[model samples]
Every structure is written in structure tokens, then in C-alpha cells.
Target chain A: MPKLIDFKLILTNIPDLLQYLPITLGIVLLSMVVGLVLALGIALVRLHKIPVLNQIFTVLVSFVRGTPLLVQLYLSYYGVPIALRYWNYYNHTNFNINHVPAFLFVFVAFAINEAAYNSENIRGALLSVDDGEIEAAETLGMTGWQILRRITIPEALVVALPTLGNQFISLIKGTSLAFVAGVIEMTAEGQIIAGRTFRYFEVYLSLAIIYWALTVITEILIRLIEKRINRFRVAQHLVGTPAPTETPIVGAQVLASKEVRS
Target chain B: MITIEHLAKKFDDHQIFSDINLEIQTGEIIGIIGPSGSGKSTLLRCLNLLETPDAGTITIDDQQIVAPHITKAQRLKFRQASTMVFQQFNLFRQKNAWENVAEGLITVKKIPKDEAKARALQELDRVGLAPYANFYPEQLSGGQKQRVAIARSLATDAKLLLLDEPTSALDLELVGEVLQTLKQVVLDHPNFTVILVSHELGFVQEVASRVLFFDDGRIQEAGTPDEVLVHPQHERTKQFLARFATQTVHN
Candidate 1:
């Protein structure tokens, strides 16, 4: 009789699955970079409520958010080649749809999916900045672009960072769907190894362990970054800091007497 | 010099102020006092085009802006002519005291970074905040934050300064430091026109060279503090001062 369980196969499957780890990470890294840029653009368009473009992007973001990632990957994978064929026929161009890489479709789908979710996170953060500070900046004669660059965006980033970090973790798990586009990432590699060995449970368990470890690492890195950026807040909680120079009691009384109406 | 004519504003159906007219001489400290919803703060905001008036024109120095038709250049020029201190002491939370003071200098005035830093330090020094230059808004007390805000406005070198209830958010004890700083600013820069809206009747009386009693979206009374705060000509002005009278005695 065949052995009931191949406990050793789980260990052996990890290194084999690890071979394709870079591909999975590559999709996440590239998509994160592209998605962040797209999200910022979408958030700004929505925040400012710019004309027709705002409505167009609003619907586009809704559709991406409402639909499943796998469906999105399938649509881009199958849809782009057909669209390209129609374009080549109409434009009288000789573009080759067959030469397009599978990973490009996966990258496009993941980035769009990430942008739709992250834009809301960014918009909330942008709105969270105090109106008072922006007014102060405006009163200082800073232009619209100057206020956004110097004051709004920097302040908004502090508010957005934690949510954006969570989005990144979700994006990592979302990249598992890359196999739907025919790209053999870690998940796809696990399935291939499972199919050959008929040890599906063991192979998947190893894959889960790797993904869990990756998530843990990402969380730690995000926390470190948060602590570093929030250093200015450290002084407020310190127990024994030196007091500020001005004597509050004396200052108040002198001001009241010297400047009072009576 | 500043001139306002037929100024008006409304939030939907609720009118904030309307058909307001006034002329302000250069180098004058103008105190505006009124009830809570009397549009005093909105009027100060309208002067710097912070609130876009629905109908009116504001002329500051050589630049003039008519409501609903303010050009970008006109708004920029008007803003450059004045700065504001908020009641909340709205210092940038992300920056230190010196950076807050230096921000307008570097970003708006396009001064060199080192020179801007020096000027910012000088302004902070004027407010007695030079030692706390590295402190963030959260690290400082309410009064210190306001002083940093004052330093920021002063460093811009705007001819006009608008203070909206500057000490209203401070602790009773902390109010004096901000009041002292404002008194010094007025004494040090006699040419800098200040438009202050405050419930601190005492400070307004001490610092304001001319006073305006704003109510129902109009200047109900305008004169020296003695005329409005002491010998008020309007019934509403007298009633307003009377309410403060009881509060002062209670304190």
C-alpha cells in the first residue's frame, strides 16, 4: 500500500516552489509601483472633481473594484490579443499579438485592481489633512500646486501610510491569481508539482507556509517604517523632558495687565 | 491701504454677510468684535480672499479684486499682501517650529534655503521661540504653537496681518503669552496693519488703534476702543459689551 502521508514531500516541495518566488514578487513589486502612481492620479482626479475625466475614472474604478481579480486577469489575457487584432486590422499595422508575454497581462490586471482599492485609501487620507493648515499655506501666498506639493501631500502621506501598507499585503496575496494569465508564479509552480506527485495537500501546505512567511516579513518592514517616520511624535510621550523656556504664568499675567482694556 | 465695497457672502440660503463697505488706512490696527455668528471672522477671511465673496470688491494697495471675477494673479497678489493667524494656531504638524516659520519664506518668497532659515530663526526669536525651534506642534503647548504661527506670518513680511480670535483657543494661563507676542509685534512694526477679530475685549482694547463692531453682516459701529468698547453708540454694541462684563466679573 502507498504511504498514507508524505510529510517529507512538504519540505521538499518548498525549495522547488521557491524557484518561482521571484516571478511572484516581481509581479507584486512592479504592480505596486505602477499602482501607486495610478492611484495618486485617480485620487487627485476624484478629490478635485475635475470635469468629465472624474466621472469616467469613477466608473472605471467601480468596475475594477466590483469585479473579481481572476475575472480581470482572464479578461485582460484573452481580451487584449483580440483588441490588438482588431487594431492591427483597422490601422493597417503589422503588430504581433502572439509575441506578447503572459506576465504583461497579469501585471496590468493586478495594477488596475490595486489602484481601484488604494485610491480610496489615498483620497480619505488627502481629505484628512486639516483645512486650517491648507488655509494657512494659502494665506502665505503659496500657489495651488505649491500647497499640494509642500503641505497637502506630505501631511496626507503620514495619514495614508498605514492603510497603504495593508493594501500592499493584500496585493501580495492577490498576486497568487497570476496563474490565471498563464504565468507560472509560485502558486502555479505548486500546482504543477502537485499534479506530478499527486501530493496536492502537501504541496499546497508548503505554498501556504511560504506566503505566510512573506506576509509576516512585509508587516514587520511596514512597522519599522512607521516607527521611523513617527519619530517627531516621540517627545510628546517622554516622561522627563526639559520644560520649554517661557514661564507660562508670568507671561499671561504680564500680558493681561499690560494689554488689558481696564 | 485697504478698501472694501459691497462685500457679500452666503452659505446656500443662509447669508453670512452682505453689502458691506469699509476703508482701512495703512498702518492701522483694526479690531473687529461681534457675536458668535456675526460674520466677523468671515469678514477677515474675505479680506485675504480666503473666502470668496459673492458680491463685492476688495482693493489692497495696487491690486483690486471684484467678487466672482477675481483673477488668479489678483488673488496671488492679494494673498502676498497679507497673512493670517488662526484661532487654533494651525502650525503644520509635520514640520518643526523653525520650518513652519521658514515655509512661506522659501516656498512663496523664493528665498535661498540658508537665508530663509536665518530669517525664520530671527522671527522665532522675536516670539521668544528660538530655543524651541526644533519642536513640532504636538511637542509644544497651545501658546507656543500660536507664537510659532505668529512667527510664520511675520516672516512672510506681508504688509497686513489678519488674526482671527488668536487667543480664544488658549488656556486661561496661556492666553497671556500670545497676547504679549501680539503687543510686541504691533509695537515693533508700526507700519504693519493688523486686522484682529477677538473676544478678548481687553487685548483688543489695548492693541487695536481703531475698532469695528460687526453685527448682521455690517459694521454696526467703528471708532477707537474708547468709543465702541467704552462709550458705545449702538444698542447692540452695548449689549455685547454687557455680556462680556458679567463674564469678566465672574472670572
Candidate 2:
């Protein structure tokens, strides 16, 4: 049997692949920011059940979520240019597809895909927030926007954070599909190097390791955020103190944030 | 003062309550006692426009709103005049006890953070939960959480405070503590009007200035606690009181 494994080649290719890491990370960050904003707007409309628009978004989100992401990428890659051409034709204006970057389609597709899934996660989190709390906020004379900002979003994000982290990790991996739209991200760079060297195993293995490392790092960051957000719970668990009944407040163990203390 | 006239609510075609009329005096603690599904909660919710009534006019303090046609500004003004304490003690999970009390003051009242914190701490002190000011609701008992909610309500200077089954969600052992807290709140603030919906007849009888026996979405009888609880007039009121009487005698 010929040498089936090449550890040295894998090590060499890893450094070469690392150069494109920024592109991969940039795509994930951009898509996540855009996707999260879209998802929140979609989820809010659904939660409020805004007549006809709510129904339309419900169908749109369902249709987006139900379809394969690869198909969506292909649709964007091929469809956007056509749609633009049609728009230009109708208005007798000049617009060109060649001026648009191919990577833009990939970004649009991934963001839409991420949004459809994340909106459900956010909506579930929103619903899980006790109705009683919202009622309390309302009766306190806070407007709907104020309640959403101060109570609903902060609390819902806490519940939705873990799932959102998972979505981001998946989104990072989802960026690999960008190669199909002719966007040379990390995986595409790997493919170009592999094609030249005929080192399929090492290149593919390096890609997998990069993605795994990204996911692990992202998960660790998410855990730290979760811990920070739930600091009171952590403190309670650490103290192991039984809840006191009718005890006069004596010493202050303040968790007061600067904003509150100010 | 709060006044409701010709209040009606319907779920699809089925009526929850219809043509309800009432005038609530300023500073009075009114107890609403009724059978389950008799629309007591619905009636309470309608007062604050939580559940939009199909037809009604609610006048709270200086603001008035016609049912189902309430403008956003009127709704906001009406809500500012009143606050509600939920049975489930709907404390904000993200907030510790003091933060829960301070939230409305800071956000709605536009009080400075330092002042809001002071007011929250004072309200918590009033409810005897000042020691647990930093504790989250999960770390507190049911009664303690309810007291925190009560503190939150008190932090806002709403003229009308609505208590919806305040003690019903508490454990048997914890009920007395919350009931005691509510009693103290009622006695201390005679100028703060309250509409209390409760299943605890004894607590209601003790704290309520007047009791309304509600049946079929209408006030069947309205009088002092002694009149409603001891010397009931309506047949439904008698039947409702008889169950409590049997339970009391059995105990």
C-alpha cells in the first residue's frame, strides 16, 4: 500500500488555510448580526400577531426553514441577478450583475437561512418569558417598547443565548457552502491548494480541524456569557444558603450594577 | 377614583361578562369574591384594559377610556394611574428583588437610578424583604416573591392597586405571611385604593373595607365584609358562603 496518510502535508496546509480565516470569520459575524436582527423583527411580528403581515411572514419563514440551505444558496446565486435585470427592464434603468460580488449571494442565503431558524428559537424564548412579567411591566406604566427593551429582550436573550450560539457555530460551518457561489473562503482556499497538490486527505482534514476549533472557541465564549448573565444564580448556588424567612436585611451583599447604583 | 360602566367582554360569541357597572371610591379596599369561571379575573383585567372589553367605559383617576376604542395615549395614562399584583408573583427573572421594584420607577417614572434604588429599597423594607434585596426570585419562597411583587407595586405611586388572587398561589404555610403583608399594606395606606380578588375568605374579610359577592359576571351583593360574609342576601352568595362555612366548620 502507498503512503495513505501525510501528517507533514497536513501541517503545511494548515498554515496556508489560516490566511483565509478572516474571510470565514467575517462572513459568520456579518451573517450572524444581520440574521439576528432579522429574526428578532420576524419573531416580534409573530408574537404580536400583526394581521396580514404576520401571516405572510409565517409562511415565508416556514418556507425558508423547510427548504434546503444549499438550494437557497443556489437560488440566490442565480435568482438575484435575474430579479435585478427584471427591475431594470421595468424601469428602463441600467443595472449590471457583474458589478455585484458573487459572495454577496452566499451571504444573503446564509443570513436568510440562519434567520428562519433563529427566529423560532427567539420566539420560543419570547413566549417562555412569563406572561405575568409582561403584565407586571404593563401595569407599571411602561410602554410596550420599554417593556420589550428592559424586560422581554434581556430575559428572552438569556433563554435564547445557548441555542443562538449553536446556530452561530452551524452558521460558521454553513459559510463553507460559499465555495459553490465562487466565493473563495477558507474551504475554497483549501480546495484550490488541494487541487494543485493532489492532497485531498490532508486538505479536507485541515478544514475539519479549523471548523472544530472555531466551534469549540465559540462554545467557550457562549458559556462565559451565560455565566455572566446568570451571575445571581451562580452566587446563590455557591453560597448554599437556605432562603431566610422574615429575616431583617442586615448586611448588604450588593449585586448592584453601576447604572443602578448611580 | 375609578368608575366602570356597561362593561362587557366576550370570547368569540360566548360572553365572559356583560353590562357590568361599578364605581370604586378612592382609598377603598374592595374585595371581589366569586365562583370559578364567574368572570372575577376577567372583570379585574378589564379594569386595567388587559382584556379589552367589547363595550365599556373605564375612568381611572382623571383619565377615562371607552372600551375597545382606547387610544394608546389614554391607555398609557390609565395604566400610570393603576398597578396590578399578580397571583403568580410575576417577578422579573433577570432582576433581583430591588431591581424588580426599581424597574418601573427608573423606566416609567424617569427617576434617577440612585433615587429609584432608594425607593425600591424602601418598598422592600416596607414589605420586610429588605434583607433579601439582592436575592433573585428563584432563591426566594413563594410568599417572599409575592411580597417582592407587592413591593414593586408599592414603588409605583399608582392610585389604584389591583391584587389578583394574591395569596392563591402561595403554599398553605406561606399564605398567612403574604396575607399579613397585604393586610399591613392596606392598613398603612388608606389613601391607596385596592381591588382585591381572592379565594381566601378570612383574609378578604379581615382586610376588605367592602366585599362584593360576584356571580355570573355581575355583582350579586355588595356590602361590608360582615354583610357579605356573615349576613349574605343573594341566594348565590348564600350558596357560595355555605361551602366556606362547611369548610370552616369541618376545620
Candidate 3:
């Protein structure tokens, strides 16, 4: 810990790390957005549990979940080049392996990985939706799609949000993996600075510290959101219903914050 | 508003019901009575296309909901007119009572949000649950929940309501409150149809304009309560009535 502690090198790299913050955040943001969209599609496919599509998602989820993240990144970065040679051979076009940017491989790999994990998160959320609720929606004449959007998805979002938040924070940390693919993110930029300045311990310690700080921030943010959602609105009828509300007819304490009505 | 012709439903190898035919006139309240194993539920579900008949056709409000190779979209259109209220009152757990009520209106009828909410409140009020509008089903009592279920059906503006033993799940005192809600609604709303399956004869007599005595898997006798309960023709009808009459007296 003491050998690599040059105050000057650490100070210079701290600013550099801050500069790379956008690159790190940008990748996290971009991959998460694209990954979530794909995840929704995959989640839907799994939810409907159609014969072919369910099988596809099953295989896809298992495959992504089974392999290590590092390997997935390495395969995308190294393997895509060989695959494109086939494209080049067939199309008679000059498809240089080098032209395939490092960022693209990293993004694609991250997106795929995020989608796999998020799909499982979302699918579990969808399943947790009460069957009675869906049946009630059915009686209301809600189409299958409408039920998913109106009651099923929104309710699932309440359940899925926390898990998704965790994934997102992990995803930001997962951006560290992007360093392997040569995409210049905060973790990687830290690595480059550490190697150059021979202050390996300080640089890595800084990276670990930032990641830990981020995790803590996300945890606090998620907890705040959970509280806000609870505070901002109780069950629709819960509004003004009163504290230690009338023992509901069924004789259970049902989250009755009646004063707060959406 | 509904017609059933030679309708039959079989669950795999077991024939649940067969050779059932009935004409439900517009605005008629018919109570379907039967024992535990009887196919009263299967019949009600068939009318709404919630359970497809193995053989036969159901025409509701002059539209065929079940026919040879009918499209699901067309069948769903018929479901809009008839809502089935379950014995356990399967209100959506995620939604509050009002969302449960407004769901069909907004989703199937494409009613606007404000309009749907307004209508849902009105229906809940109709069932004496205006205050419980925003309450989730889990929060409501067995009686309150059933009223919400009834309100959900009413909110859709469905002309026909199918109660599959609507009050069977409630306790002695609770049952009357739900039945009273239904009775009040019946008195106030004209051009509404109700087909109920129940073991409670007094309730059947109170709400059903006519009653059918079912035994095994078929309708053994069909007539007004005076005819079926008071002057029954079938042995099974007589048997059911004797039990019902005694139970009513004791309860």
C-alpha cells in the first residue's frame, strides 16, 4: 500500500479519472438503455413462454449466465474479427478486423450480458404478479398486451425496480470489464495511469474506492426512492384512511397510508 | 341475451357436461342450482367463452361467441357483454378496488381515463363501496371484496352477470350483505341479466326470477320458484328443495 503512494501521481490521475467519468457513465448509460430494451423483449418472450421463443430465451439466458463476463468480452473482441472474415470473403468487401472499434465490442458484449441478467430480473417480476390481478384484468376486457402494460408491467416495475437498480450499479462496476476490451473507461484509464506512474497500489485503490462509493450511493438512492414511493402515495383508498387504519375487513395491516393519495 | 345449443364441455377424458341447452332471455335472472359435482360452472363459463365447449355454440346478445372455428377476437367481443364473478372474488391483488373496476372499461371499451375512473366510482357506489374504491382486494373483507368484484362487472356496463356461487365463500352474516348489494342493484337496474349458481335457496328465490334444479350434470327441472321449489316435478328437485327448505329454516 505504501510503495506506490506518490501524492503527485495520485493527484494528476484523480483529475484524469474524473475526465474519464463521462466515458464510464456514458457506456453504463448507453448499455443499460439498449440492454433493458432487449431485456424487455426477452422477458416478454419468456413470460408468454411460447414454445420456440421460450426455448430461445432459455438457451440465451443459460449461456450468458453460465459463462464468465471476462470471457464474453474477450470472445466478442477477438472472435468477431474471425467471424467478419467470413463476411469479407462472401461479400468481396474489405472488412478490416481493426476497423471494428473496441468500444463497439465492449458495448455489444455488455448489452448482451446486461440483457441476460435483466431479463431474468424482469421475468421474475412478471411472474410475481398475482394471477388474480391478471384474471381481474381479463374480466375488465383488457387485451393480453394491455394487461401486460397497465397492471402487469407497472406492478412488476414496482417490484423489479430495486433489482434493476442493483443491476445498474453492478453494471457501472461491470464497466471495469470494458478495460479488457480496450474501451477507455474509468477503471482502464486508472490502469494506464498506474502502469505509467508506477503507482499501481494507489491507482487500483482509487478505482476500488470509487466503485465502493458508487455502490453505496446507489444503495442510498434506491432506499430513498423506495421511501418516496411509499410516502408520495399510499394505496388509492389508503389516502386519509388514518394511522393504524381501521383493521381492514380481513383483519390484517394492509399498507394503508390513506392520507397520501396519488 | 344469451342462447346455448347442445353445449358440452369435457376436461380431457372426463365429460364435465353434455347435451345442455338453455335460452337466457334478455333481462332475466336465472338461478342455476346444483350439487358439488354438477357442471353449473362449466355451463356459465361456456356462455362467456371463458371455457370453450367441446361441442355446441353459444350466442350472446345475438352474436355467436362459440361456433365452429370462431376467431378469438370475435369471442372476446362477446365476453365484454358478460362478466363472470367468481365465488372467491378474484380481484387483482396489485390494483386497488377502483382500478379493478375501471380495468375492463378502459381496456376493452377504450373508455377515457377520467371517464373510466368516474364510472368505476359510480359502480363501486352502486355496490356501497364508494369509499373502498382505492382499496386493494387484500385489504377488503370477504364481503367487501365480493362487492368490489360485483362492482368490476358492473363498471364494464355488461348486461349479463354470471355469479359462480357468488356468496359461497362468505360466512353466514357476510353472505346476506353481498346478496343484498346484488338485490339492490337488481331492483335499481333494468335490462340487466343475472345467472347465479348457489346452494342457498332463499337467496335464489330472493334474486332469481326463475330457477333451474340441476342434478348430476344436467338440468332436471326448470321453472319459477313456485313451480320448482313449491311444486317440483322432478324427484331430484324435490330432494334439493327439501334440503334447502330445512337449511333456510335453521339458518
TM-score of each: 0.90, 0.91, 0.86
- TM-score winner between candidates 1 and 3: 1
TM-score of 2: 0.91
Q: By summed lDDT, which 10 consecutive residues of candidate 3 chain B come out lowest?
A: B63-72
- Candidate 3, residue A30: Cα displacement in angstroms equals 3.3
Best by DockQ: 2
What's the candidate order when arranged by decreasing TM-score? 2, 1, 3
- For each candidate, what's the DockQ? 0.41, 0.49, 0.39
True-contact fraction per candidate equals 0.54, 0.63, 0.31
Fraction of true contacts reproduced, model 3? 0.31
lDDT for predicted candidate 1 compared with the true structure: 0.89
Task: Tell me the spans in candidate 2 whose CA falls farther than 4 Å from its real position.
Answer: A1-5, A232-262
Instruction: State in Å the error of residue B127, model 3.
Output: 2.1
Clashing pairs in 3: A133-B92, A140-B104, A237-B134, A238-A258, A239-A258, A240-A258, A240-A259
For lDDT, the strongest prediction is 1
Local accuracy of candidate 3 as per-residue lDDT tens digits, A1-262: 5643665655566777877888888888888999998998999888777889899889988999999999999999988888899888999989788877888898889899999999999989888887766766666667778878887887777788998998999898889989888898898888888778777877877777777887898899888877754432344453224333344422323334423323
Query: What is the TM-score of chain A, computed separately for every candidate?
Result: 0.86, 0.88, 0.81
When 2 and 3 are scored with DockQ, the better candidate is 2
Query: For model 1, what is the alpha-carbon lDDT of residue B163?
Result: 96
